[model samples]
Target: MASASPLIDRHGRTISYLRISVTDRCDLRCRYCMAEQMTFLPRERLLSLEEIALIAERFIARGTSKIRLSGGEPLVRRDIIDLARRLGRHLGDGGLDELTMTTNGVRLGEHAEALADAGMRRVNVSLDSRDPEVFRHITRHGQIETVLGGIAAAKAAGLAVKINMVALKGLNAHEIADMLAWCADEALDLTLIETMPMGSVDEDRADRFLPLTHILDDLLGRFDLRRDAHRSGGPARYWRLAGTDTRLGLISPLTANFCDGCNRVRLTTEGRLYLCLGHDDQVDLKAAIRDGGLPAVDAAIDAALAIKPRRHDFRIAEGSAPAVARHMSVTGG
Candidate 1:
């Protein structure tokens, strides 16, 4: 394996962002995310908090500057704030530049202050609909009020919050504009995402796959949107919404491929590093660590980067299997 500071894949993209899924367990079962009766990994199979921090340290040492902690609902993990604090220590003076999270907002109300105290300045919360009935239907059994309260708490704790909404054709498509306006009113950033074919869920993804192009066309007539160069170290194309401080982002994985500049990799809870979201290319860092500690893990990472694919094979069709067998929760959102 090659010894390098910043990991560069064979495709020549610099890898600087690392997303770690601390656990696969979630408090809610969103229809687009997973099955209602999903089987979660056993606790013993997950990387201990200490091990996650150690491996994350290796990535930081290799020039990973941004780290985002995610899960089915990251706040659901016990002592997750501890992990944030451990990794937060890496910030400042030529170390990790940013430490953030992607959560469902179910438990954010309870942990927001701790997370802010742990050095997190921002977070991305997944919320599909503001309508109570629609929200419960999409999430199967989630209370929108709980999520809203969590968002309130996060903001109160001085964390900049961004709302992530998965666009669904018949379900929430009519509410996208309303959601954007609500985001603007709340002084929050809003990102519209096209549903990806990741896991086997109850509904047909093709029916819910609302191309962002159609949504953008509708918004163009209503809002004064201009292309913005703001990048949040993710795959979203940003636009500055005129008349408000809200920045709108669109993540269209199917219609507009964003893999050419992919700069991130995912680390599963089980210690597997997935090169691409829609591919199975992986390296077992947990085994590497248990077998030979940090040096072995470093070599394994280099080997994985050498084989990272230039793009992912993502497609959506009726009666089709997922792009990969694994769910989005397994790889983190």
Candidate 2:
């Protein structure tokens, strides 16, 4: 922990983890994620793969150690494996300590082995429900079997697999126990994330927003769940299932905020730098890089770090929340 690094924000949070979104395109349109007939980003607007690696290398040089590739679905990006191979060069030999991705798992089954061979360490697959019909309904038309098969493929490829479920109140609350049980049976770590007030989902948000605290309360009442004292670099705080290796993780962005300990930043496919996930504040790094190269990147990073909000000032208070007008897909989940 060097005190002189520019990645340290005003709040004393060191930005070590950088999430790079490869594309804003997705196969399935989830209700909470995007609206029907949502417009996609133009292909040319995205930063080139070479630019992605160059920007990441600059971050690594400045003490950023972990990089996670993300997207509306990363696999949909053309030549993503090539990008993985290029970014992998920034890891582990006094470089990035880990390289990972958060995918919808739509295309993971076919590309898992190649991704591993290209140096991805692990993957977090988004699977909201295990029920086929419910899964299709939630994702607008996604195949549960496809995601399941992809998870299996990732596991077989020797990549550490973790399943992420966006826990909603009236929607999937009843299936919480089923999700936990299934993860245990599959020997996969399960992380239950509370719905955040991002994008235009505010109209039905309050009614649908389920806090992770409530889910934990139910699990604690029904089973012997205890917190694991081990350190996990990510936001989720884990609780191990008694007598088994399967653990439950809770990410409460609304009811409980983790910003005080935040250690990451996000880079959108078009190169907008989001210092916090819930805010609209962004630094146009694409312009910086296009204009002045690495020196511009260094200056932009320092400027963004200086004004990084101490905590996300999300607009939500039961009645109305301003339309974020952006979805997690474009924001890289």
Candidate 3:
């Protein structure tokens, strides 16, 4: 095996963002993230808190500053607050600049305060539909009331809350305006994400896939929104709702690929590190941790970074590329 390649990728980009999936278990079965009959990963295969912290420590030493805990639903994992505490300790003395999480918000109302106290800076809650019935239809078991309660609790806990909504055409497209209006009222940052053909969802259901451009155009027609200067970062395009403190973001990963400036690496619950969203290539850090030590784990991460593809070719025009088998839930957003 080749030795570690340090922090730089093949394109010489510095890797700083680390997205770690704590568990492959989620309460809801979102149509886009899991098959009808899902075979969740067994318990033994999941990475322990210690193992996760060790890998995080190694990466922090190598210049990683931002860490985001993700999952099939991060809150689904028992004692996730403990994992957050351990990670917070490892990231002491400004080692990690920011610690965040993305969840479906089913358990947020119960754990939000504890998570905020444990050194988490913010949270991004995935809520695609405002209508309770639509939410249930999309996520099989999700309760809009519970998610809303979670969002309120997160806000009360003092953690910066971002609401992520995937704007599917026939599914939740009509609710974009309402969602944005609700965000404005609640003073929460709302993000509209375009659907991608990367999960178990029916690819032929093209009607459900609404492009970001269309969403933006519709929003502009209805609201007096303007581009916000302060909220710009990563792939999310920010816009401020006129006369309100709330802001909106558009994450057009499919319509506008920001791979050139991409600086993130995703770690699955099973400990596989993926360099890109559209690629099957990965490095097994869990195996290294079980067999070797921190040095071995670092080497695996570095090798993965080195092999990180410059960009993903989704083949928009041809639409012939193979779909990404790892659902968004398993990969932890």
Candidate 1 local lDDT, 1-333, one digit each (tens): 222567899999999999999999999999999999999999989999999998998889888999999987888889899999989988895789999999999999999999999999999999999999999999999999999999999999999999999999889999999998999999999999988899899888998888999999999888999999999999999998998889999998899999999999999999999999999999999999999998899899999999898998789988888898899999999
Q: Where's the lowest-lDDT run of ten residues in candidate 3?
A: 314-323
Candidate 1 lDDT score at position 295: 86
The order of the candidates by TM-score, greatest first, is 1, 2, 3
TM-score of each predicted structure versus truth = 0.98, 0.95, 0.93
Global local distance difference test of model 2: 0.84
**What is the per-residue lDDT of model 2 for residues 1-333, given as tens digits with 9 covering 90 to 100?**
112354889888888889998898899887767776778888889999888888888888888888889989999988999989987876667877889999999999999999899888789999899889989988989999999999999999998888899987677889988888888888888899877767764246777778778789999988788999654567888899897788888888877778888998999999999888877778988999999988888889899998888787554556676346678888887
How many clashes does the backbone of model 2 have?
0
Which segments of model 1 are wrong by more than 4 Å?
1-4
**Cα distance off (Å), candidate 2, residue 10:** 1.2
Tens digits of lDDT, candidate 3, 1-333: 222444788898888888899988788888756766778889998888888878877777777878899888898888889889877775567577888999999999999999988898689999999899999999987789999999999999998898999887788988999999998888888999876667655444355667889889999999999988663335687889989988888888778888888878988899998998888889999999999887778778878977999888653323343367677777778
Those runs of model 3 whose alpha carbons end farther than 4 Å from true positions after fitting are 1-6, 90-92, 202-205, 230-233, 315-322
Clashes of each: 0, 0, 0
**Candidate 1 residue pairs in backbone clash:** none
